[model samples]
Target: MSSRIIAAAVAVAAGLALAVGGAATLVSLARPDRGIDLQNAPAGNGVDGGVVDYGTK
Candidate 1:
């Protein structure tokens, strides 16, 4: 019983840590100024920019 409780606590802690890390990563990625570029512009779109660079102009 004690071992099970300990395991459950550890699992919960790990899950919370992973969730926080994932949220932070997504927030960082969604930022425009310093986020990663994930755009998929067409070949002849004539608009060369990142995914979050729409409002900077």
Candidate 2:
């Protein structure tokens, strides 16, 4: 086959791969099942008392 034909085939394959990947990402984002409760996330100053302890300094 000619170089032009091979190049076109490669471009088409790459485009299809990108399209499939983007579609999958969108679908997964649309329907999350991790059960994580982001709205009720723990506060930084809650029982943990923040992530850093400045008293050591």
How well does candidate 2 match the true structure in TM-score terms? 0.47
Model 1 per-residue lDDT tens digits across residues 1-57: 999999999999999999999999999987785323436434445565534445664
- Per-prediction TM-score, please? 0.47, 0.47
- Candidate 2 at 36: error in angstroms? 6.6
Query: Residue by residue across 1-57, what tens digits does model 2's lDDT show?
Result: 699999999999999999999999999888845566676676765467656456774
Using lDDT as the measure, the top candidate is: 2
Model 2 spans > 4 angstroms off: 36-57
**True-structure lDDT of candidate 1:** 0.77
